[model samples]
Target: MIAQIGDRLVLEGTHLGDARRIGIVVAVAHADGTPPYEVRWLDTGRTSLIFPGAEARIENRHPDETSEPAR
Candidate 1:
């Protein structure tokens, strides 16, 4: 994974439940986009969360810094 900040996270849960959430990438721990992500989660009712590696989506951000999608 080589994503940047302010990007969306698309992850797959390996547990037993079926759920999904869309959040913004507030912080990036590693440059590889592997772990340690601070995201304002959307599943737990607009709360901030830190995902390890399996809970994330995409990193959709424009380099121009024009406008990002508030998803």
Candidate 2:
């Protein structure tokens, strides 16, 4: 994912009936938009650094828009 600061990261649950996890990217660790992103979770308002797996997707935030991911 070509994520930047303010982009939302949505982690789709692997198991059946599991809930998805959503968060905003607060910091980007590298210039190429690789992993080890610092994200702030929507549900708990907590922050964490993550290296995403196959279950994750990125929601880009346009320069002129404000976006919020689904809970």
Candidate 3:
């Protein structure tokens, strides 16, 4: 679930009309290094940043992942 430079962030697969998208974590923001990643979701050929917290998992990005709003 950890997001990395090649991990895929899948959102609402079946319930959301089977809508699926993929992207790479271009950047990560974390202080203590824990859950919640500032993911840059590549949706529908476009790029969108997100901080999917407890609602998400970490299986790719480094351990120093955070949810700080990108500036």
Candidate 4:
């Protein structure tokens, strides 16, 4: 998947009862916005370089005024 800095990377759990993990993309390895992103996780406050898996999805950044309402 393609992502930009500041976009949220959400990794859904593979098993039942596992919590979803969320992180912000701090750096992008490719100019075209491909994987190997440097992400800072919200839960652990740690950074990691990730080539995202099938369970991962991107949430693009948006202005406060233009953002959708929380579900």
Candidate 5:
């Protein structure tokens, strides 16, 4: 997945009734926008490196604007 610094990452739960986790891409470790991204969680003000799974998806930084979703 390719992302910009302000993009949002949503990790869908693996099982039923599991809550979704959302985070913003704080840093792009690579110039090519590859993972292990430095993301700051929206639910909690915590940051970590994330290598996304199959359940992961991305929300564009400005949802009201005409930007594309990164995946």
Candidate 6:
């Protein structure tokens, strides 16, 4: 999936009782907003480069948005 910087990447849990992971897209590897994003995770305050899998989804950020949903 495509994503922009500041967009949130959500990786749904792979198994029962597992928690989803959320991260902000800090950098994009391609000019066309393609995959291989550099993300800073919310939980542990760590950054990683990721090629998102099937369970991942993007929550785009809009300029007019006031705030993000509760984590």
The lDDT for every candidate, in the order shown, is 0.63, 0.90, 0.50, 0.89, 0.83, 0.92
Winner by TM-score between candidate 4 and candidate 3: 4
- Ranking of all predicted structures according to TM-score, beginning with the best and ending with the worst: 6, 2, 4, 5, 1, 3
Q: Model 6, range 17-68, lDDT digits (tens) per residue? A: 9999999899999999999999989898899999999999999999776655
Order the numbered candidates by lDDT, best leading: 6, 2, 4, 5, 1, 3
Instruction: Assess the local accuracy of residue 56 in candidate 2 as a C-alpha lDDT between 0 and 100.
Output: 98
Better of 1 and 5 by lDDT: 5
User: lDDT tens string, model 5, 1-71?
Assistant: 88878898899999999999988898988999878799988788899999998899877677564543342
RMSD of 6: 2.0
TM agreement with the true structure for every prediction = 0.54, 0.86, 0.43, 0.86, 0.81, 0.88
| Stretch of 10 with least lDDT, candidate 1 | 43-52
Query: Candidate 1 lDDT, tens digit per residue, 1-71?
Result: 55567776666666789566666677778878765677766555363556546455575677777654543
Best model per TM-score: 6
lDDT of 4 at 21: 93
Extract clashing residue pairs from model 6: none
Clashes of each: 10, 0, 7, 0, 0, 0
What is the Å distance of residue 26 in model 5 from its true position?
0.3
Q: Pick the candidate with the highest lDDT.
A: 6
- Cα error, residue 38 of model 3, in Å, equals 5.3
- Model 5 vs truth, CA RMSD: 5.0
lDDT of 4 by residue, 1-71 (tens): 99988889999999999999999898999999999999988888899999999999999988563432243
Off by over 4 Å in 5: 63-71
Give candidate 2 regions above 4 Å deviation: 66-71
